[model samples]
Each structure stands twice: as structure tokens, then as C-alpha cells.
Target: MAKIHSHFDHVGSYLRPQALKEAREAFAQGKISKEELLDIQDRLVKELVHHQVENGLEVISDGEFGRSWWHLDFLWELTGFEAYQQEASYKFHGAKTRTTNVRLNGQVAENPNHPFYRDFEYLLSITPAGVTPKVTIPSPSLVIKRDHRSDLYADYYESWTDFLDGLAKAYHDTIQRFYDLGARYVQLDDTTWAYLIQQLETYQDQPEQRRIYEEIAEDDVYVINKALEGLPEDLTVATHICRGNFKSTYLFEGSYQTVAKYLGQLNYDIFFLEYDDERSGDFAPIVDIWNGRDQVELVLGVITSKDPALEDIDAVIDRIQEAAKLIPLKNIGISTQCGFASTEEGNILTEEDEWKKLRLIKTITDQVWG
Candidate 1:
């Protein structure tokens, strides 16, 4: 077991093992009990934590095994939201997800009894000593970005400003709870930053849409920062700007240049950015946001989690050196562009392929940073 002192990390989610997937399906189909399904998830997650340590990872996640979609499950479980089926599923590049999304139904607040609390507890119980247990959930920005609001939102809250205030308070409460639970490393897996940047690009000519998105991005930063204010310095909060990962496909592309103003203002301790392909554009955005700053660390997601073919180690090392010119080598790290699975579908790569990728990241980080 190793203490978490470097940027050698991965986005929290991993490929859900086949047995856990089957157990979830069985429970859905009324073929198994809920307890039985959780038993399977618990067993598989323990194995995942051990697997991660063996691969040289210092931080261990539960692999998001307790739910289906990484963001949706966590959002709907909160106090004032509920899940429902839409007329059509969310369309990804080459795949469409199940027709499920959350809708805000009441005054948004934190549920003192979130299931993730227990799920993270189990992770801590089984995690080997010195390997930091990381608790990951959706960011506060996502509930608003994903359009989980229905007309019913107006019924519970008088104005949009009131709603946002509640959201920030709820997130603050939830994060404080995590700290109390002995969680030092918590990651907010977010797609809102990418969504905002994409929207800015999508509606450049439309003044109204541009203004609306710009406003939303600012509010998003405010909420995240407010939730993170006044926390213990020892708690390391990280965020990932996912560009929609589903079955080896993505929904957003382009650089981080447009959203630098907002990204630079976020209060998180680290940023896990995607640089797996040219679609991520240049590292120029690094300078745009973090120029001359050493208080925060930046982890380059140089490996492609969507693809099984291992990256060339020499090429990867060269790319890292290229980024090091912008930021100090001590404050830089390597990881996959996103998790192996944003949902339970778990990417198109085999589980063995994932281990090889992690090993590559470990080797790259050690050789470059050591």
C-alpha cells in the first residue's frame, strides 16, 4: 500500500465485472434479491481495489459498481430528485443509453442517508492500508447542466436563484458528510464544463444562446466553489470534465480554450483533463487556466480508455515531456482520458486490457517523475 502523494491516479469508474453486471440484470428481472445483487457488487469491488493496488495505483475507487450510470444514479439518489424514463434514450456517437433520466421534483437538498455513504464505507473497510479510498460522485454543476429540471421545479422554488442556492448548500452538506466519513480523496466526475464549452462553440452566432450558456458556466463555477469553501485542507477534491463516454463513443470534442475562465476559478485541488487524442486539441489551454500556478496539480489523461490497443510508451512519454514545458514536472501526472465505464456498459475493452493500460500509466509516471 502506498500513500497518495502524487498525480498517479485514474478517473474513478472501472469496467464493471461480468458477474456484477449479471447480478444487476437478474435483480431487475426479478430473478434475484437486492441483497444478492449487493453481495455480488461487494465481492467484485473488493477484488477491484486489490487489482488497482497490484497495478501500482495509490488511490482506489469502488469502480462505481453500486449503480448504472455514474452521474444519474448519484443525482437521483439525492433528496429532491427522482428517476424516470424519457420518450427516447440519450444518443451517444454510436450508442443510445436506456431511456432514463432524473427530474427535480421538490426543494433540492441532501439526503442524510445516501447509499454512496455505505458503498464508500465498504470500500474503506476492504481497502488495504495506505491505499487511499476515493469516493466519487457527480458534480453540483451536472444537475443543472443535464436539464433534470421539469416545470415542477417552479412549483417548489420561486426563482432560479433560489434553486441554485439550495443546490450549493446541498452539495456543501454532502461533501462535509464525506469528510466526516473518513474520505480524504473525493472526485466529482463532471461533464458540465465540456457541455458548456461545446455549447459556446455550437451557438457562437446565436447571441441569445451564447449569453445563456455563458451565464450558466459562471453559475456552475460559483456553485462548485461554494460547496468546496471552508473544508479541511487535507481533503483532496478532484474533478474530471468528461466529454460523454458510452460504448467506446463520445458526444463532445474540441479544446479546453473556451472555458478557461471558468475552469481556472474552480476550487478543486486537481484537474483530470482528457488528452487522449487530437480531439482534445492542444495543451495551450493549460497555460490559459493555470499559468504560473503551482498550488494545484494537473493530471493528463494521456491514455485512451475507450480503446483496448495499448499506447506506445515512448510516444506517450514524449507527449508528457511536451506538457511538462507548461507546468512543473512535480505537479503533473498521467491517467486515462476518462473512466473505463461512465456507465455500467464499461467501454468496449476487455478487463485485461484495462490492467495493461494502468500498468502503462504507472510506468510512465515513475520514469518521468521519479
Candidate 2:
């Protein structure tokens, strides 16, 4: 088996082409057939894969083109989850997102016929040899974190641990399915960790709030570890920590200090952390947790994806070197802080800018790592 490296990685999601978005909307409104919608997705994904290869990236993804929302799309495909438009939208910083909410409708179980299976198959069919095909899905913690009304499902689960166990089993089966389909590198795009950091500010003054935050932090690690159990040794698990990306506006803000100790508890091989700005805080805490671990790698997101402005190469290199002072240089990699498009809306940047950002990552990565 080829050893998977996190060098010059992307967070998986890419900006959706306008035509593809329109086609999806049409399909939702009953104007286009599912086949027609998929055809559009297939074409665009082919182009996206080509772009990734042309950019000199070793790992390629389907650009998550087959779905609308990143987490909701996958969750809704499960046995007992249902997606519905909520009455209110998620209010981000100076931006609003579409009100798509997923609810627990039945018992959660893995659906063997999940559409992402076919999406990955299409991506693998088009990818060239030597380039690894990667698949990104919402971490199991997101499912538990977003279950805002679990109380309503009291009849379904007897306790919180029971609910988490079911979700973990479903994720384990789903991951095994992806692995069987030849996905050696699987990434879990998680924002729940960042949300926990945001809670630090909200509960700093109250002892009870602080206690609850600590409990959730522990639970977050438990859920992720459970989901990762019993996987093949050759399969590489990566996780991308997100601080929210929609229309270029962020949803949460904080440093890793709040969660630094818990970081080592996650069983992922690589961690694609967001450090594009001050909102991500400094890298000292990362150095503290990852100091002696040779099996783990860190892909520091030194480039910003929220805007069109490009970062200076020298400055980015300086930051990377600074991080190396703590973590070993060999275990470090480079990538964007988050995906260019966490949702269908994407960030406030042009397609050209997005490509340039990726190119910039490759450039910086070579200069630093070489």
C-alpha cells in the first residue's frame, strides 16, 4: 500500500459551478430528472478533477459536487434522518444561509445504497493513476451536535451514550464501504470542535457552563474514536477542522488552546487545521500536543479561502517555519484554511482566485518542504 501524505491537501469541498447549481435547483423543483442533474454533476466533477491534477495535487476528490449542503446531504441519506427546510436560516457573521435542517426521523443506520458511494465511484473512474482518490464526509460528532431536538426522540434511544453508539456503528459501516471501494484516504470535515471553542467565550463566566463545555469536549473525542474503530491499517483517516465557511462569512471564532489537550485523543492520521487568520489563534498549543507523535501529521492551513486576496509567499513561509520550531518539519504540510465552498454558495471568491489559491499552496508547500 502506498503511504498517504497530507502534503498540499485541500479541505475536500470546492466551489460549485453556476450551471451545476442551477441544474440542482431545477431538479429540486421537478423541472429536471435526477439523471439529468447527475449528468451535470458528472461533467463538472470531471472538469474539477482535471483541474486538481493540473494544479499538481497528488490527492483528488469529486469536489463534493453531487450534493448541496456538506453535512446535511450525507446525514439525510441515512436510514432514520430526514432533511427539511427550517423556518429560520443560520445567521453567520454578516451573512445568512439557506434553512436546511436535518432531523432524527427514525433509528440511524447505514444505507448501503448511499448516493456518495456512486459519487466516489465516478471520481475513481476519472482519476489518473498515482493520484489518490479522497472522500470527505461530515464527522459523526456533527450528527450528535446538530441533533438539537433529541428530546423528541426519547422513545428511540434510552440514553445519550446509546445514541452515540448507534451513530458510531453507522459511520463505521459507511467508512468500511468507502474503503472497500478503494478509498485509502478518507477525510472527516468537522466544525464541531471549532463550535466548542466558540462556546468558551459564551460560558467563560459561569462554572456550570464551563463544566458542560468540558463534558461535550470529552464526548466529541469519544464519538470520533468510536467511528474510527476497526478500520484497516492501510486506510488513512484525515480530519479537517472548520470554523464555518459560507458566502465568505464565518460562524465561529477562537483559538485551539481551548481544545488542544483533546486534539491528541482523536485517532486521525492527519489533521488539516485552519490557521489562516487570528481567529485560529497561534500554533503553540498544536506543538504542545503533537510534539512526540511520529504517526500523526499536521497540514497547517496558511492560506485564506474566505477572500480573493492572495497571501504573500514569504510571509506564509515564515509562518510555516515558525510552526516547525514546535512540530517536526517532516510532519507538517500545507493547505487552505477551509474548503473554498463549504456549502453550495461557496466563499466570496472567483473560480480563478480559487485556483490561484491552490496553486499558491503548492508553491509554498514545495518551497517549505523541499
Candidate 3:
């Protein structure tokens, strides 16, 4: 697999266009047929691909136009999982999302008929010759860590470890399916690891709570690596580690120092890390874990996707230089801290603001890496 050594990259996803959003709502209420809804999605996605190329992004996506939420839509499509209503929505800094979550229906397994496989085919179909069409799904770690239905595990698996293996197998087979379909680049958007960082921080004084979070963190690392097993070498895989992003609100804040050891053990070609603000902390922990791994690129998210304001290019360059003191500049890339829309609700930013963010990144990448 060749490295994604491009100086600029993006966390895959864009704000869902209003037409597609309205079409989805109408379908839910039975005002439109599935075929009609799909027609809107197909048309919107094609326009998104063209706009992405025009905006100068070498890597692009379908804008996740067909989904309600970034991770939940993908999760529910997998076998043995179904979307369920939770009593409380995910708590964020200033917002509460719809009361949505997932639950286990049976022992987790791969669904060959998974919609993402078909979606990836569409993405490949419309992508131009030179641009990279990236497929973003919630990480395998997410499926394991987000399973809150503990009582149902007894009906599905022999032990907790077995359940973990089941989740990994599902993702492993599913990811392989994507690769077989001509997907050269895949990005796993993970909040589990970053959630662990927050847990350890919030529970630092409580030994029991701290222990539980630590144990789950270790389990997540195992599940993730297990899923990547046996995949071909030429497939470029990356993981974007971020705290929850929904409606311009975040779930937690912390340093990578908490999860440095686990980050070192993962087998990914690149790490699309969140460093948009002080919340992500310094790059020393990154240096400690990623040192000497020349094949990997530490793509920094210096620009804020959660807000409409653009970052000062020179200040962004200064931060990259700061990270360069630890990791080589050649191996460091630049991107928005996360996607413009991690969920279909989108961030507080507008479509034009999103494009400006990309243009700013292109300007920065050209100046630093040219």
C-alpha cells in the first residue's frame, strides 16, 4: 500500500445538503418513496463530488448525504445491531442531540448486504480520475465500546472477550469488502479512544471508575488491531481520534497523554488527530508514541470546523513547526480538527465557510510542503 503522504487531508464528511435532508424527513413520514429519496441523495452526492473537486480537495466523500448521523447510520446497517431510542441524548457542551443510540440484536456479524459497500461503489463511480474518494465509518472500537446492553451479551456470546472478537470479525470482513470494491483509502472515525481519555480525566480520583475506563481502553485497542488483521498492505487505512462532535458541541476535552501507550500499538498508516484548540493538548505525547514510525503521518487539525471563523494561516504554520520539533515536518499533514459535519445536523458553520476552510488548508499545504 502506498502512503497517503499528501501534506493536506480531511476527516471524511460534509454538511448534509438541505434538499437531501428534507427528502429524508419526507421519506420517514411516508410522503416520498425510498426511490424518490434515493434520487435526491444520488443527485446531491454527485454535486458534492464535483464541488469538492472545484474547491481543490484531492480527497473527497459523498458528504454522507444519505445518513442521519455519521456513526449511527453505519452502525445500524451492520448485522446484530439496531438503532434504539435512549432516554437521554449524548451530553455536549451546549447542545443535546436526538435521543438516538444502538443496541445488540444478536451475536455481531458482518452483513455482506451492508449499504456502505453499495455506497462506496457509487462514490467510486462518480469520483474523477485523480481525486481520492474516502469512505468514513465509525471505528470497530466504537461498536464494542458503545454496546451498553450488557444483559443481552449472555444470549449472544460465551464471554466478554468473545463478544469483542465478534465485533472485530464483523468490521474485519466488512472493511475487506470495501477494499475488494476498489477502496484504496479508508478512514475509521473513532471517539472511543478519545472518550477514554475524558473518562480517565473525569474519574482520576475515583479508583474504581478509573479502572473501568482503563480496562475498556485496553479492550478497544485489541478490538481495533484485531479488525485490521489480514488486510492487504496496499490499502491505506487511517484513524481519526476525536471526542464526540455533534451540532458544534463537544463531549469532552483532554490530552493525548492519557492514551499515548495505546495509540502507539495501533497499526494505521496515518492518524488524523484533533489539535484544533488547547483541548487536544500538546504534541509531546504524540512524539513519545509515534516516534520512529516513519511510514505514518500525523495530520494535525489546526483549523476549527466547529466554528465559521478561519484560522490565521501563519499561526497555524507556527503550531505545525512546534509539532515538527517532535515529529518531522515531512510526516505532518494539515486538516480541519474534524469534519464540517460529523452528524447530519451539521456544525454551526455554513457551506461557504466549509469551502473556505478547505481553501485555507490548500494554501497552507502549498506553502509549507511545496
Candidate 4:
């Protein structure tokens, strides 16, 4: 809703050093109370919001302050699910696999309260005098990726139509409730579709797995479209798709060509695509759907958030100009390739370094869009 743009990342760094150190130590010793943890989070979040506003960012997020991982924990809050840490491994760059018993799943046990709404409610108290805050949540489609849920079986919803419809309703209800509370922008952090597109090889290696991957991609679009069925025409809803961002490295790397057809049909107001490096591929495929009738805007990730190196503002402007050849400049904007903190593990950059990246993005954007 604001004219200036900002990147989303971790809120942990925004905490007062003493408070953060205390929280970490207390959690480690299992000596902290939930209320104490939340209280510190609240103070940190308020400061985070003020910091963003001061730094010249247009839209503000809670910096995903309270959650551990961006997608999973929120997916757990959706409905009929429980989450727990479990042993699992993910392939990192250089073909290295990291194994950790991180948070995995249980079931869609009950429809507990949505964290997006509760967090926003807490954030409302800290919003700056005039700035409108933006809320970001993992896409509802992420539920498909959560550690094997029993209810999501072969005949889970009686029919594919029923399953999709339910998903749409749940997301729509959740987002609408937030909109009703004065949120002008709601962003769906959809890494599921992006990952499916990039990991085709991983799925293709096993015939049995390919079908599940295809179904999830198709169903993600269906569910997202369904959720957007009816809502405020003026409320801006955006989607940020990334291959994966963990500890300054990536998991999947590819372009939109794999899912371009479905991606072109999404119903969001804007699409924040990761185009920071060669791994994202050329922008030609994106140009194909850039002028579609659905009224989608493109928030180009021209600045690399993963590395500490600052982009030459002149070169960044040239790329934006280059992208305009395919899509109108009016429909384009710039941001970091992904959030400063896609996960708690965070990018390898220091807090000072991370903010420097944001500053560069803001400076370049002012030059190009001003």
C-alpha cells in the first residue's frame, strides 16, 4: 500500500540484544514461560516495525518475527494438523545434504486459531503513526508438503473437487478476516509451486512420486484461485515464489518454464519472483504472461539478498529497464530475491550486512521508480 518497497526476513535480529540473548538462553534451559517469550517478541516486533518505517520501506511485515520456519509452523496452524521436530535431510548446494531432526508434522488434528490473525492483532498496537502493515503467510498449498498427514490420503476428501474447495474456503476465510482488521496487503509465501517446478528431476526419477508432485502443483493453483473467489477488489494480495532459501544457500534451482502455464493463471495482485541469479533462468518466459488480462503485477527480485555484495545501482536499473521490454514498466517493481530471513537459520550475512542489502534495494528503487 505504500510507495517504497522492503524485504521480509527474520525478526529475531530486531530484538533488543539483552532480550534476545535472554530468550535464547531461557529457551535452551526450558526455563522461559510462553508469556515471557511472547512479551519479548511483542517488544521486538514493535521495534521492528518502527525500524522498517524509519528505513524508508513502504510495506511492513512482522518480519516473520514469532515463527521458527516461514512455511511449516504456519502450515501447522491452518487446520487439522499438529507439528513436531523430526529427523529429516534436505539437499543443499554443492550436493551436500544436511540432516537435522527439525520440525515435521502429525495431523490436521483440530482447527486451532490462525496465527496470522493473532500476530497481526499484536502488531496493530505497534504500527507507526501512518504506515499500513503488510502480512505474509505461507500458502495454504504448503499443507500438501508438510510431513505425511494421515487425513491427506488417497480418498481424503471424497473427491478432488471437495478437497480443493475446502482448501479455498479455509484460505479465503483466513485472509478475509485479516483484511477486515485493516490489513491492506496479504502476501502468500508460496515456495511449494516454485520447488515443484525446479525439482522435476527429483520427482521424475521415481514414477510413483511424479504423480503426487503434479497433483500438488495443479491443486495449489486450484486452491489459490478458489480462495480468491470473492474479496475486496482494492485489497492487494501478492505471492512470493522462491526455489528455497536456507542459511544463505538454496535447495531447488530453476526457472518458471516448468510451471509457467499454471503460474500465469494465478489470481494474485502481484508476483514476487526470485530472479537474483542465473539459477532463476532468463526472464523471457515471464514476459509471455507479463501482460495477461488477470491484472497481475511483477515484483522483480533484481537485488540479491543471499550474498553480501551490493549490486551496482546502475546495473540494477539497466536490468529493470531490460525487463520492461517484456512487461510494461508500470507493471514492474523491485525487491530482494527473497526475504532476509527465509528461515531462522538465516542467510550467512550479518544483521548489519542484511540491512545494507535492504538499503541498496531502496536506493535503487528510488532511482528507477521515482
lDDT of 3 at 45: 92
Q: Residues 61-83, candidate 4: write the lDDT tens digits.
A: 78777776677666667664556
Worst 10 residues of 1 by lDDT: 1-10
- RMSD values, in order shown: 1.9, 1.4, 1.4, 3.9
By the lDDT metric, which is better: model 3 or model 4?
3
* C-alpha lDDT values of all predictions: 0.86, 0.87, 0.86, 0.70
Q: lDDT tens string, model 1, 72-151? A: 89888899899888788776788988888888888888898999999998999998887889988999888775664434
Error (Å) of candidate 2 at residue 353 is 0.9
* Displacement of the residue 144 alpha carbon in candidate 1, Å: 1.5
Question: Clashing residue pairs, candidate 1?
Answer: none
TM-score of each: 0.96, 0.97, 0.97, 0.86
As for lDDT, the candidate ahead, 2 or 4, is 2
Query: Once superposed on the true structure, which residue ranges of model 1 sit more than 4 Å away at CA?
Result: 1-5, 148-151
- Cα lDDT tens digits for candidate 3, 76-119: 88888888898987888899889888888988888889888877
TM-score of 1: 0.96
Clash pairs for candidate 3: 1-233, 1-234
